[model samples]
Target: MPKDPANNICQTHIFEGIYNKYSKGLHDFLYYKYGVQTNPKDKTQEAFIKLWDNCKNVTLAKAKSFLFTVANNMVLNEIKHQKVVLNYQKKPQRTYTNETPEFLLEETQFLEKYKIALANLSEEQRVAFLLNKVEGKKHSDIAEQLGVTNKVVEYRIYTAFSKLKAELENFNIK
Candidate 1:
């Protein structure tokens, strides 16, 4: 280990620490956002390599953001280069003889309001809330993935629920 601050520049130990702390999160983020089409693992590694090549200039506070930005840009560039047409089909409506038309209409309206409420959340709040609720991630897992503390994750989820609850107060949640 280099004891001198000046000598620690791009040191092996420093690089390893950065890689260890961020690799899994970066990989998971890329995979979640781009799916298999972006070759997320490869793109994640490319981001790390880019970071390593510029290690001297990257501070610890900015490293994570830098990695994500590079990965996002790479995926965006690849997307622009390829013309893709998705074959999308809407799902058939549910039919239940036991339920009244009014009930079905209410349910559909509730779902629409819920989606609108979710969409209105700030990006960070939405990400935290979705990772915890939709993805079934524990607070610790979300914190690790977000490079934040568990308390921050808790706060985010709590606030998200508060906002959603307030937004949907007119609906019957039962």
Candidate 2:
């Protein structure tokens, strides 16, 4: 079918208006969902561009949902790609000349074991653990930041800890 230039221009205006109104909210939503900043911005920008490209088919009332769906899918795809890259990356071990050979071998083994254990965790558990432990975010803060209930955040943390503890039980490194 032939395209309508006037309709396209009108749709572009509508999409621009929507983007101006909701860009901040969309960015925040993406950040909270992904626990990252740069990717969230990229996803938000991509979502807006998608909306602009498909504006003629979308109504104003459904624009927010469409943007969110696009952003969520983008984040998921990025995460999956990152996981694949991480899995294929070679592990880099640090060498210390001062350390005894036995100590160095044990340390390398322990590090590799820990990495394998961590990789076994569920995505939500891993994310919760990183946000709470690595990022030093409180459960309540993480809950609010992630748009979940505080109790759910606590549960996720507990689940993550239990799984990690079970996986590392043989190491006795605490």
Evaluated with lDDT, which candidate comes out highest?
1
Off by over 4 Å in 2: 1-10, 90-174
Q: Which ten residues in a row have the lowest lDDT in candidate 2?
A: 1-10
Maximum-TM-score candidate: 2
Clashing pairs in 2: none
Candidate 2 root-mean-square deviation in Å: 17.6
lDDT tens string, model 2, 28-144? Answer: 988886677447888889998898777777667778898999889988888898888888775665555788989989888878878887789887788887899888989888988
How many residue pairs clash in model 2?
0
Q: Residue 83: error of model 1 in Å?
A: 2.6
Instruction: Please provide TM-scores, in order, for all candidate models, with all chains considered together.
Output: 0.43, 0.44
